[model samples]
Target: MCGSDLHYYRAENDGTPAESRCIGGHEPAGVVESLGPGVNGARLSVGQRVMVHHYSGCGTCMNCRSGWTQMCTSAPAKVYGKNAHGAHAQYMAVPAACVLPLPDELSFCAGAAIGCGTGTGWGALERLGEVGGLDLVVFGQGPVGLSTTMLATARGARVIAVDPSASRLEQASKFGAADTVNPDSVDPVEAIRELTAGAGAAAAVETSGATVAATAALDALANWGRLCAVGLGGTIAFDVRTFLSRQVTAMTSWSMSSVQQMACADFVARRNLPVDDLFSHHWSLDEAVPAYEEFDKQSAGKAAFVF
Candidate 1:
């Protein structure tokens, strides 16, 4: 589930890592082997292939009623790999409401990617609003950041990608990034300003989850520009006065809702986006731990655990 599983598995008591011994994996695509009695009327039938939303909320919560189940506040929501057993096993039992039917044409791996990384990108794009013709900057070239770059570019935005790895920058360029910046060699903010004709980017998506990357993204936004933070890195301090003077808006984007996740999956299928290109490595469950270690090492492209 985005390589964070390793952190939790290695350190059980750390605040950043949950103290659960459950099988790890939140992004799952599988067939419905059986249905609980309560979900019988929800239209989910056996033998139907589907993707699990991985996060379930109490139906009576205000957030759930408002169609934003991701924000449910009543009960401690159950999420794969965090609060409950995840889908790394052959079979995962999930609430019926958290499952989405997958078109036969979509591959299981592609469906799994959408459940988390791609869905997060879709949500961030929704939060930014109207990205057409905007100069966009993505701070990292991981799966989430690369997905954002593809979506933003498809929407007619000129994208500038920033990452310390040359290989990732090259991959980002292949995914429609108009320009690439390596923060290790140059000041990313200055490079972004130069690329945007001294105005900086119209919108910036920070997916590096590092304090330095967050600061750079904030500094690279133009006046009144929008900065959407999607990374899982720890917090960082920012100067309110600087943002106030520039009229910049800083927003944090969490995982997407079920609706948005489904919408993204539909968009990918309709447009025939290159989902295959995003996956560069694959491993079975027995290889999962080593696969995650390689992912943590920042291997050149996306990695997936195959069934």
Candidate 2:
């Protein structure tokens, strides 16, 4: 399941209303049980196992037509496992446009992560800029942050990963982080600046979703540096003068378009990266109770639930 499920659970866990309940998995994959009417034949067919982009929108809208169906304005967007039933069930009905063909080399779990978790990081970096030979700071060594670290490093960037969790920091190092910082032990901005010989990181990406981390990421940028923000939600307030003076570019990205998702999977396969390194635990649908308890601890990476 995507981490978005945990977010919706926490944000709306308050006495929202009876109608607020919705199916919760977003990153999902399985065979194409059947296709909807007028579904295109280019990317999908019956019995093909595929991962989905999760958002279904009116096909006529500009956003939908432009491959950004998630931002469609035609109607209230229905997200798989959110307002719409997602892939957690034995079968699912997804738009053909939302589907990405999965190669036999990739497992269902890897496909699921590509649909969201890794896709999110990939999209963020795609928009961030060329990272080759650059010093990059990735705040929050969660799943998305780890993906950013791994991908950025694979692109030849020297990665400096920052997080409070020692365990996660260790994982970041294993994932190609050139250096790691425990925010609890030192100011990440200062440490990152020091790591870059006081020029600050050549680029930065903050996936912590914490305002404090976001602010520090902006402050840790080199002159003319770019920062990609993919964390869920947080008010980011930084000194405008400093940002303007440094010519820092900050952009927000969610996940990859269905098209970009295939590119990510290709990168994983071609580069032979260990996408499964993000998984810390696995379970089955029958083991839901304990799975929930383990995930709530937030001390591990993404967990998988086999059907």
Candidate 3:
């Protein structure tokens, strides 16, 4: 997906050779040069452009049977560029079962952007439960946060976006956020409270890795509010009493199911939801070094590597 933190899967410092020396790319897309035999249950064809959903699970697992291959129980989950060879190559040979036909309207760049981060953001909203006519706040204006904000707004919710970067907040505004907050200056929780007329938001999504953002995300919600945390690193702490009092339903949304992932990409294309707006940077596979360098520094919005 077109996410900054998603490069963590490609980080060399992780002490795993799967990253340092592997052909690294999970948010993969391109034409299907070929498909392995035994690929069943999907309608992909040769030479068709496609977005590769990142999930290589044992077919026997219930998780895989349900299309949540990320939760494969028969074996440790094996995904491109993570535990196996990846898609950042001239040619890839993934099971046809794991590929989705990218709409002709979607760019390969846009297709790849839906790889993980965008789908992760979409997954969070799918878990948010009936957001229509609700007050929605997203903590962070990065790819995942922006996706949540955009999709929630598309679902008829009023979206408030929060981030430390003013520039990102500006992008959020263009992505359909009703308002933006910079927590670096004022407390996001307080700002959300003020914006929501002190009742807090009806729901919130925390995509910032900072622990404070997690707590702030929860703190900014009204009673019985739903929240989904998608950030990779952090520790959230709050009094049990406050949590109990609010009756909050907290969920940590990870990678989405295949159905959810396909629906998200389709939703983007069908709605013409300027998902490309989330991407401020693009590069070719040959320029991957500088691309990751800039994105690793968190310099801009969503980034994707073009073949």
Candidate 4:
């Protein structure tokens, strides 16, 4: 499951109501059972393995046409597992446009990740331009941050992972982080600076949504460094003069577009990267309550409900 799933589970989302009872799982990967009317048979067939895009919107809007259906201008977007039926059940019905071909090399679990968590990492890295050979700091060792760490290492980046949790930091090392820092023990910005030999990081990605971590990520960047903020929630403040003088470019990335999701799956497949390693738990549907209860502690890696 995604960090967003935890937010919704905890009723922490402002966009969702307290009394709302929608199915909760947007990271969906499954076989095609059947097709809705007007869906070309050639476009999707029974038993085809696929991942759903999760967001449905008015078909004609510019955003929808561009494959960012979540940002459709014509109408409110329906996010699977949020405001609409999702993948918690044995069967799920999604619009044909929401379906993308899963790579033959990836398991359905990896396909599920491409639907949200891992795909978000790809989108954030895309915002960072060329990451190869950069000294990059990734704040937060959650699933999204760990995905960024793994993906950046594949791109030849030297990654410095920051997190308060020791277990999560250990996972970062397994994912190829060159160095790990526990912010609870040391000042993250200072640690990042030391790791980079006082130069600070050439780039940073903040995935904790913690104000302290976000500010530290910003402060831990070298001049002209790029920072991609991917975590949701929390407010951050920085001095304009410092930001201007550093020449650092800061940008925020939402989950990802459908095209990016497809590309992410292809990239993972071709690289043979262990995207499946991101999941620490494979839960059956019956174990969902305890699964989520364990996940809510924020100590484990990604968890998935396997059919």
**lDDT values for all models:** 0.84, 0.84, 0.81, 0.90
Candidate 3 local lDDT, 1-307, one digit each (tens): 3453346544565665642466677888888776576655267667788888788888777898888888999888877776667776677777767888888888887777777877888888888878999999999888878888888899899999999898889888988999888988998888999998999999988898789889888888899998888887877777888789789888888769888888888988999988777777878778877777777767777777665
* Residue range 86-181, candidate 1, lDDT tens digits: 988878888788889887778988898888888788889989999999999999998888999988898789999999998889889988999999
Error of 3 at 222 (Å): 0.6
How high is the lDDT of residue 266 in model 2? Answer: 87
Per-candidate TM-scores read: 0.93, 0.94, 0.93, 0.95
Residue ranges of candidate 1 with Cα displaced over 4 Å: 12-19
User: Candidate 2: where is the Cα deviation over 4 Å?
Assistant: 11-13, 36-43
Residue pairs with clashing backbones, model 2: 23-81
Q: lDDT value for candidate 1? A: 0.84
lDDT of 4 at 133: 97
| Model 2, residue 40: C-alpha shift (Å) | 4.7
Q: List pairs with backbone clashes in candidate 3.
A: 1-116
RMSD of 1: 2.2
Q: Which pairs clash in the backbone of model 4?
A: none
